[model samples]
Target chain A: MENKYHFACQLIREAGQFIKGRMTSDLDIEEKSGFGDLVTNMDRETQDFLIAGIKARYPDDAILAEENGVTHDIKDGRVWVLDPIDGTVNFIVLQDDFCIMMAYLEDGVGQFGLIYQVMADKLYSGGGQFAVVCNKEPLPVYQERQLAQSLFACNSRMYAQNTGGVRQLLDQCLGIRMYGGAGISMSKVLSGQLLGYFSRIQVWDYMAAKIMGEGLGYCLLTLDGQEPDFKTRQQVMFIPKAKLTEVLSYLKGVTI
Target chain B: MENKYHFACQLIREAGQFIKGRMTSDLDIEEKSGFGDLVTNMDRETQDFLIAGIKARYPDDAILAEENGVTHDIKDGRVWVLDPIDGTVNFIVLQDDFCIMMAYLEDGVGQFGLIYQVMADKLYSGGGQFAVVCNKEPLPVYQERQLAQSLFACNSRMYAQNTGGVRQLLDQCLGIRMYGGAGISMSKVLSGQLLGYFSRIQVWDYMAAKIMGEGLGYCLLTLDGQEPDFKTRQQVMFIPKAKLTEVLSYLKGVTI
Candidate 1:
């Protein structure tokens, strides 16, 4: 586990460096599903680099990555979920606020996680036996803040649709913020920069941050009341455990 | 003018440094107008420090600032508009994504501007005879992009109200972002990281970025078509010249 954790961190840093170097250059950007759902050449290249590094070390580990999807089923042994670049739109447009995320789950439990904010050069890594650290500093323990006293992040779609009383929830919270990426947004929550995040996210998006955040007393919930698995996308709330009931009451009618 | 520009830059950096140092310390946070609109002791201290510096260097200049409001009416020989800490909420909570902004106007015409992103250590300075420079590097000239090609920043209130067909406008654009502060959001637009910003803004909030942005061929407009003065809070759009007519079409019925 120790060796794997160190290897994951190293590979992520190298991938981050590679992505950082390409930011100023021309990107071969392509639309994945729609206009705003952007994918760039750097995304593919970075994912291949991380997957190659992982395969070389742990040949039998199943890899599920954003660009290429999963290599195999998550039945047993080790499964690595990767989002080579978490905020692809931000990467293509701003060259900032995006992250490289990877989570290592063994047989079904999360064992290790990493989210590297490339431009800022901040690496949030931990889980398994290690505590989450931002670069060299241990992330400060966050207080459990109430729903009304803290800022919340709700993606524009949720806010626009007023999904599950999102508009009402925003009115109750201190304010709303939109970061455009699950990795960076959840990172903000884990670091106590934000009170919590409410958005629809995939397994790759929430897995790494969930592991690190839960270790620090944060909570992750699927709004639909189904147990999260490595398969489906769901409306999830990553928040302080104390604010769970309060936030959920507002998001009651929200589904998917 | 050169001396004042250099002086403003020096004073802003000093204030930024002072504010940055105090971020990790205890903050006396208070709500100003509503729950989310916050003010802090640091905001007051930083404002006082900047005002004192300006008085020492340019004693006759009229100073209009956020914390203390205007020193006097703007029938000016020279006026300095200052926002000691532009994103007070962000400063109190996230401790990032806030800026110290100042714009120097001579006889009501923009003469100099400065916005220091304290945590990032980025100083965007220019105006009068100087072109905008980001930490000694001249900002790259941005091409005018169509509304469909850009991301926009809309305050939560505006988006929720669908004010001026904001919902329809958001649909046509690539995406919507909410940055909480006028300074950081406008800075993103001025730097090409965002397409434009639309929100109700006071004089000090838009003065600095407005000066710097206008010099770069960007345009500022009041959604109500009113000529902006230093006395009123108005709905404004800071965007590329090419996007004006197109964006205005969607916002036809919107009035602030």
Candidate 2:
């Protein structure tokens, strides 16, 4: 077992259990600019926990987070992009299906990442030549399944607009699903439960999953068929090799 | 507590646990018709389990099921509609988020229903003047939320065709979500986690949920502005009273 993967499983398991315990108490929730965008005490506490742990073990590490801003320079030794609670709104409202996510980068390249579905107690970790695994079960490399043979997970932003491309893709897929969070949806694709995922998300949302998915030999492209620049929040699609072309054709001319 | 509600929780919980145990084994998967139409041994085994239990306990009562078809006349004294595995594709593929659903009708009147999310071990049950409870926590009466304030869950069939009303509503709402199963999506609304649900679903899918939502003061209406005719699988929207008018206005011309 790689030290990073071992450390991730233990750290995320503790964070998930701790956050779930806090959910039973009265939650202190506040909106982050948007009305539906939620952040809570648990989110901050969990974020701080991860940051403190990384800083203690790797003092030179860089940290970029959703709740709190960046800690160190990406040009520095190791950088970790973390979304302590990816589905903060889901966390505040449903208390289930939300996630704790992290991506560890070596210098500049994506190396290790974890997307943990807390309520379900399933942690997906991989990258840097490591095979992805859910719990302890090693996930085989994702095989290319046709676009018509699988379900697609998407964010609400796509539906709120009902883009023609999105509508076309939804029509062609076997079915559709949304968990209101990038972590669970991405995990769906990573574990082969879903064929692909389309969403407009931030670096903190997709970086970890992207790293792991790339390690599995999948295509991580923007809806416009460009590699994700990771500079600004952009529309991204993590798809299996077989479905990439078909999904991209549908996504053309749409500002995903 | 009504005998039916008590019975449903006990029956469905047992079924859920039994089916989950079987999921670890090698599943016998066969196609019902198309690729997305899945039927696993667990689905059949669980459905038969529920049917046999019903026959043993209430031999005279009618039963309607997804796999085995109607066991008795709809005009019989009491009819129980059951979908042993609500999300069969999810069950066979992802092995998570599938549900066990049942609705009991007495002389053609919706009386009590159970929509149990098996993987999550949370059951939503109500009707017969009982408050809905998930596990031991009683779900509060669903307060009306605006269409602009919360999310809506819908089926891809509506989006595939881009029914003018459906697209307009999706574009206008806070966001849109799809759980791919009516039982799970409706559970989201019943628990106040989602604002509404729109889907073209079968009797086995919506009967129990419709009964519980109606009991909680939700508006259950077809897009064509008529009462849901159980005889036909029709497009139905179960929404809060606050969002009903706006949603209905969008559905005026569409044949749901």
Against the reference, the lDDT scores of all candidates come to 0.83, 0.79
Question: What is the C-alpha lDDT profile of model 1 across B14-119, one tens digit per residue?
Answer: 9988887777788888878777678898989999999899899778788888885556565577888889998888887787999999988877888878889888
* DockQ each: 0.78, 0.48
Per residue, candidate 1 scores C-alpha lDDT tens digits across A14-99 of 99988877778888988887867888889999999898998998997888888865555555778998999998888877879999
| Residue-by-residue lDDT tens digits, candidate 2, B1-256 | 3776787788999998899787779988787867577788888899999988878878877888888555544446789999999988777666777899998888887778899999888899887677766776787677756566577788766765665478777666656677878888888888888888888777888888888887676767787666787766788888876666777787777653
Every model: iRMSD: 1.1, 2.7
Whole-structure CA lDDT of model 2 = 0.79
TM-score of 1: 0.96
Q: Give stretches of model 2 more than 4 Å off.
A: A1-8, A24-45, A71-76, A159-170, A242-256, B1-5, B24-42, B71-76, B160-164, B241-243, B246-256
After superposition, candidate 1 runs with Cα above 4 Å error: A253-256, B254-256
lDDT of 2 by residue, A23-90 (tens): 77887877787756778888899999888887887786678888866654544567888889998767
Query: Share of real interface contacts recovered by each model?
Result: 0.73, 0.53
The docking category that best describes candidate 1 is: medium
TM-score of chain A of 2: 0.93
